[model samples]
Target: MVAWLGSYGTSYFGEKAYPKPGAVIMQYTGLSEVTKHEPPTYECVGTRDGIASYHSVRSYIRKIKKNGTDAEIQIFDGLTHGFGLGEGTVAEGWINEAVRFWERQVK
Candidate 1:
């Protein structure tokens, strides 16, 4: 599985050099044309994110789901970008959710 944040996440999904991951957990990232790299992808973004628009993440999720892949997304209201593990934000517990999503792929 691949767990990435910010531009790193976009690069992992967009670039072909990296080996294809079994699943992806993307956090606060913009959309990359990743139709070719469809995997069980889990995405999270804050609605108030300025760096990476929440709409981009939603669009990416829609595209992946359209390709018949298992895609899950969580949009946290009133939160911004780069809050790793959501810390004290309303998005707390997102890591646990991502872990569960990854575990489902293994099964």
Candidate 2:
């Protein structure tokens, strides 16, 4: 299992230096490319995020699902980039959701 955010999340898909993780918890990354053997993925991003496009992230999840790899996403309203833990925001509790997704994937 791996939990990554932003550029690290993007690299999780691209990096070939290490063995692939069984599941990935990705956040706020617009970089969307589905590898041949992508692990199950969980993602979250805010609609108001300036850095990562919400649509791009959705498309990425769709692509992953299309390829038969499990994927899920949480889109928060009126939130911006890097809203860490989303404390006091609509995105609060997103980590719990991501963890649940990770658990399902690993099981």
Candidate 3:
């Protein structure tokens, strides 16, 4: 099973790619158009993100779950875009969770 992890525009590509993935991990983007056979997804976003609204991401996750897809989202407090790995920030360690989510699918 294939899996993907990306941010912003790349995340959209991961979502729309052919054949889909076993799981998807995205950050700080709010594209909400869900497909019929979406894979399980793990997402993270900052509540204070200027580029992407956490609200939109939350709404997207709801749609994902409603479509019978497993989805999880983390809305970090007081952070913004381009905070890679979120080192020393509230969003730190998010990648570990995303990886665990992916591992579950591939197993």
TM-score per model over all chains:
0.79, 0.82, 0.79
Error of 3 at 66 (Å): 0.9
Clashes of each: 0, 0, 0
Give the true-structure RMSD of model 1. 4.7
> Which candidate number has the best lDDT?
2
- Cα error of candidate 1 at position 23, Å: 0.4
**Worst ten-residue run, lDDT, model 3?**
1-10
Residue 38 alpha-carbon offset, candidate 1, angstroms: 1.7
User: Model 1: residues >4 Å from true position, as ranges?
Assistant: 1-19
The 0-to-1 C-alpha lDDT of every candidate, in the order given, reads: 0.78, 0.79, 0.76
The 10 consecutive residues of candidate 1 with the worst lDDT sum are: 1-10
1-107: candidate 2 lDDT, tens digit per residue: 23343224445567555645778787898677666466788889999988889999899889888988888999999888999899899999999998898889777
Q: What value does the lDDT take at residue 67 in candidate 1?
A: 83
The sequence of per-residue lDDT tens digits that candidate 3 reaches over residues 56-107 is 8898788878988788999899888777899999988999999999999899
User: Hey, what RMSD does candidate 2 come out at?
Assistant: 4.5
lDDT of 1 by residue, 51-101 (tens): 888998888788878888888999999888888888888999999999999
